[model samples]
Target chain A: MTDRTPGTRSSSGYSAWRLIAEELRAEIGDGRLRAGDRLPTEAALAERFSVNRHTARQATATLAEDGLVESRRGSGTYVTGEAMRLHRIGVRTRLTKSLGEKASASGNLRVLNSAVEDAPTDIARRLALDGGKAVRIETTRSAGGQQISMSTHWFDVSRLPDIATVLRRTGSVTSALRESGVDDYVRTSTVVGARHATASEVAVLDLGQGAIVLVTEGLDSLTDGTPLQHVVTRFAAQRVRLDIEHPRAD
Target chain B: MTDRTPGTRSSSGYSAWRLIAEELRAEIGDGRLRAGDRLPTEAALAERFSVNRHTARQATATLAEDGLVESRRGSGTYVTGEAMRLHRIGVRTRLTKSLGEKASASGNLRVLNSAVEDAPTDIARRLALDGGKAVRIETTRSAGGQQISMSTHWFDVSRLPDIATVLRRTGSVTSALRESGVDDYVRTSTVVGARHATASEVAVLDLGQGAIVLVTEGLDSLTDGTPLQHVVTRFAAQRVRLDIEHPRAD
Candidate 1:
């Protein structure tokens, strides 16, 4: 039943399944397993690991749980293209990376609108600012010259000392934040939902009447847990997909 | 320090933190705590639960881990809308419900393309069919009036009798399979990925050039583990967010 030669194992007392999963995970991480590659069957895997069918199945399930493999009912299991790509660090990172990857692949981002305004009540509360003290940055992002999303990110002016100067000079909020010395931060929370696009969103995104919108609001904080930013992004439903990678607990 | 009346429990059996979390969870499940509703400060929760500040924070952390609440650095935790609305289930249930929900959300199916062509080598192997014998159905779906997603589902004609008649009459593939007397079935496996949309997918989805596509491919099987179907769905990136809720084994 062995379809591939069993690799030499290290001295540690790891289970056959763990060893096999590590091998496959290494391959995926190292870029050897491309998106469309087909993996060996369970029987073959069992033989290679010198284990029973149950152990082989468990190993395969581990990979599947990690979003690494796809199995068809009558068809065999195969590697998915999505599993080959590296996910961004946090929710916002995921969003920005997804957009950047797609945009870089076939298009470019265009700044449709850029403005500074008073933070909305929700944003104000999220940023922990007095009602009128929070500053909001609004930008409409486009790909291939077509608008895809509108983002409004709020920052507490008390924390961000020179917002207007940074906005006028750099244009990228992330870059500005980093330049301002708050480089180490993690996404504290993300809330996502879907609804019909508003008239302005429809006009800007060029969406049809029936098109929906996916909304994501997130908060980011420093390591010591100081809330740094709050951002809300709305995407034209027809144009994008949001993927979240969930690692299984051991 | 009590901000509001304590819940049914005034127990010292469980830790005060545990009691507080249970109360909040019950509130969320019962819809008393709606999405976007902010919780009271740590001091307030501490007073209500008769717990120390650290214990109250720990309770909030538990809620955050379950994706039931969002905690900003300085701002208090708030209920997440999606967390309240969507139930994260296993991969099998996700695939089944996704199709059902998509169809329900999008009122009609528009046959973007269909053919009785030879399956690609990868697809043929996936369906366990001779390369040329697999029948493919390609459909684009729309909600209200605008396009939302595209799907390509395949079946081996040799295994599925009267495929054309079933497709023509039932409209729903799951229903078609049910009518064919294939009552006992389960999703054997699923693969998921995110990527830049292809030119064809972009056109079919009406997505902007930079929009990401979330793709899910799976196999459904009979109780005896006989493969029944292979299906692939491409969702417009901005329209949907994939959530996988894994149970912790602690």
Candidate 2:
């Protein structure tokens, strides 16, 4: 709040309201303002910025347009939860770890369906099965009662026949793999892309059809170099930001 | 192609048209069909898939809907250049390497604008230069005459006073940094997100307003751990996919 008065459009020449909005955005970005915290009243903001109430309202309006804040009819404007959740992706990236160990109790995996089917060409090629059959699992993962991602995972049924059963019991892919005697696996490659959510994705993720979905296609291989699984995950972009940690080349 | 006859709905129970589209999509995905390659005519596809012309037409329609192919009317449809350019994100990832050395002559960075201004709060904080002035460079990178990304970069002006001059001479950030006598740098962090393109982005990227843009915010630091710059790049979703290579923990 260091004199964010936007004095006469210093160097950047940004309008006063725009500067105010930017300051608020920075506050949220840097954690000075947390998600869902109600902003000060317009009068307070105006007095602080040495501006009129109308100017303060304009700033809030700008924030709303950026999906950073929400205004209530009777209450003050509050920051939206759009600061975004950072999902770190690494060689050993684990969804469970990213979601947090404490979240496990409150989170659950809903297996929409499971079936044995001829692997799609892309999945088949990635898994090196070449037209072989695989177990396809459609699942939605939720954390703290909020939907996080919808994923379709394909695994060669020949290698792990009891995955669905184990998954159902454990609600954990790692646990299921361990039960199936996989021991361990590591992600070999990940292809990240983005697209507008489809109709089904919109309904499944409870997001707008036009919303963006961060698509990740990953291939995991066992320590012995045997391909184990190929998965496609669609993450709600508004809620998740992918943090890629590149290892140092020593 | 692998008897993609669709056989009046294979074991998966997908419709003949859907199976046909899947087969074609696979061909494109697997590099069998290249961008700009003309797809088989409806009659040819009908004969090949053992379906009627109507079914083949429906398949092409589905591909068109998915943005995998475009109908050219009178002429056969062509595979859209959406097979995706994989941009690897790693500690030592280089844009030149991702775009390929062969593309260097064809790919060029077009400087849209540059200005010296008080650093925006978010950029300032990321560069650890709050309230400091920086040089902002706006650039659009093109490879083989097609726009790939639009990036805005901020660097401490005090450290690199002649960045704009060097950038203009070399048309590369790395080259400019080298010219400014800053030898080595490494990416410390990268945050990847996505959102619908804005009007200006839609125009610049030649995409629809609702088209997705892959946003990456990255920080680079000197080898000695001093922060050097912050950059925000928006990539056209349809044109690029980020390949994240996680180092093997041997």
Best-performing candidate as measured by TM-score? 2
Candidate 1, which CAPRI tier? incorrect
Model 2 chain A poorest 10 in a row by lDDT: A6-15
Candidate 1: where are CA atoms >4 Å away?
Answer: A1-97, A100-121, A130-132, A164-168, B1-84, B88-250
Residue B146 displacement in candidate 2 (angstroms): 1.5
Q: What is the interface RMSD of each candidate, in Å?
A: 22.8, 11.7
lDDT tens digits, residue span B63-161, model 1: 775566898777778987644223232324433355445346323655445567677677788677865587787877655344556788788877775
Model 1 reproduces what portion of true contacts? 0.03
Reference-based TM-score of each model: 0.38, 0.75
Best by lDDT: 2
What is chain B's TM-score across the candidates, in the order shown? 0.56, 0.72
Q: Taking the tens digit of each residue's C-alpha lDDT, what string does model 2 give over B1-250?
A: 3334446653322356755665675466545787999999999999998899998998788678657799887887999885477787777658867876545832387788899998867678777776779999998887755677898889998889889878877888888898899877988788888875644665677653235678888888887778898888888887788998777756
**TM-score for the B chain of model 1:** 0.56
Q: Any idea what lDDT model 2 has?
A: 0.75
lDDT of 2 at A2: 40
Identify the runs in model 2 with alpha carbons over 4 angstroms from their true place. Answer: A1-69, A100-102, B1-68, B72-75, B105-107
